[model samples]
Target: MPMPRRRLILWLATAVISTAALPPLYAQTPPPTVAAAADLKFALEEVAARFERDTGQKLRLVFGSSGNFYSQILQDAPFHLYMSADEGFVFKLADAGKTVDRGRLYAVGRIGVIVPHGSALKADGELKDLAAALKDGRLQKFAIANPEHAPYGARAKEALQHAGLWDAIQPKLVLGENISQTAQFATSGSTQGGVIALSLAKAPSVAKLGEFALIPESWHQPLKQRMVLIKGAPPAARAFYEYIATPAAQEIMVRYGFAMPNEK
Candidate 1:
């Protein structure tokens, strides 16, 4: 039987968590929902899977831009925890009384250039190749997450600006909704290449599609990834939040190319 529109709205608003929803990620569950930045897609999934396997506690993880997740939390989206790619979001939520307290830094993120195999562009960390390609007309569309709301995108913009290519590259930009999609566009052969979270580029699936190199960290603001628990977080949510700081979780993050907070 076809469900009524009212019931569907209620179910979707309260239960389902998907990136395609009008306004995405959400509330309650057999286990509480966790809103995480898209940059953490690969690393966090592995950490959460380990948590579930070892502790027998399940969690519903939803990934998207950190800024969007912050807005959702402000609207009382019911996510039991939030892992933001930028620590500022967590601090802002803490000030707003949305989170229990300011979150702990879980990982330090890095952005890099990914050029799909056979592109004219080279995976140059210093962006010298990018500037050369832009000047020589070898570059057309270049993918990046939307800088307005995605932390990794913001860093990518800063790096380009530092390289003095922001204005020149502006004509050839393809903006993705988040880091994962940015990496996808970079490797899909749609665009020549792009700047995306290092963690995403490190994924075996993504790595096979391209060559990647870390953009110099000095080019932009730091990506201090942090995680926090909601005021009324469930036991599983609290436990997972704690577990993310453990050695096991940090190792998973390192595997995905993130630097630990404790590192210099």
Candidate 2:
């Protein structure tokens, strides 16, 4: 074997070259994680799917109340981006320097009255029928998200107050952890009716179970949805942040009943 020194040297050089050409283990970065508002469950899912198909990028989405996510991000949660149903939370994060910037308003959300089949309550856009029902003792166990943390819940409260029914409905209210859960509560026969995100009410699965009518925009403060990249966000998250503002994604959001930014 010692007689083949030249060939052995050539073989060793080839092995070193191949090893050097191999990519580093760290090169395979995992997909980014995005903390999103619960109202975005259906719409964001579609946009994320489209993003993967178009650009081969993937995102891991976690849906919750925006206010809760805000608190978690302040505690240094691992989310790469945060999408809030309320722009206020995004501004606070930017002020804290927890986000890449002040964030951008992505969409405006709306709340609606949803009633399941055989419910005595009518799916009225105005709270007129709701008022009449409450007056007559026909309303019981109505639902809304917990207003303390959920933007939709807060808006729902405002709308009720606008209709002068907040005090009357409070006693009969069921509070969901988030708006999506509120939608379930609205149609699960647990509650006679509830105010839920219009986006959720528009889903075919949810729509099939109930009738919905949009509460007027003037009834409450606008649900201004905003999104921001977290500090040290990975490239994928940044890409998503940009993609969400694109027309394709906005179209999906619109289909889900979200009013895109800059629209009347």
lDDT per model vs. reference: 0.91, 0.93
The residue pairs in collision within model 1 are: none
List where candidate 2 sits over 4 angstroms from the true fold. 1-27
TM-score of each: 0.88, 0.90
> What global local distance difference test value does model 2 have?
0.93
Error of 2 at 61 (Å): 0.7
What is the per-residue lDDT of model 1 for residues 1-264, given as tens digits with 9 covering 90 to 100?
A: 989999999888776555455552565358889999999888888999999998989989999999999999999998999999999999999999998888788889999999999998999999999999988999999999999999999999999999999999998999999999999999999999999998998889899999999998999999998889989999999999889878898789999989888732
The runs of at least 3 residues in candidate 1 whose Cα sits more than 4 Å from the true structure, single-residue gaps closed, are: 1-29
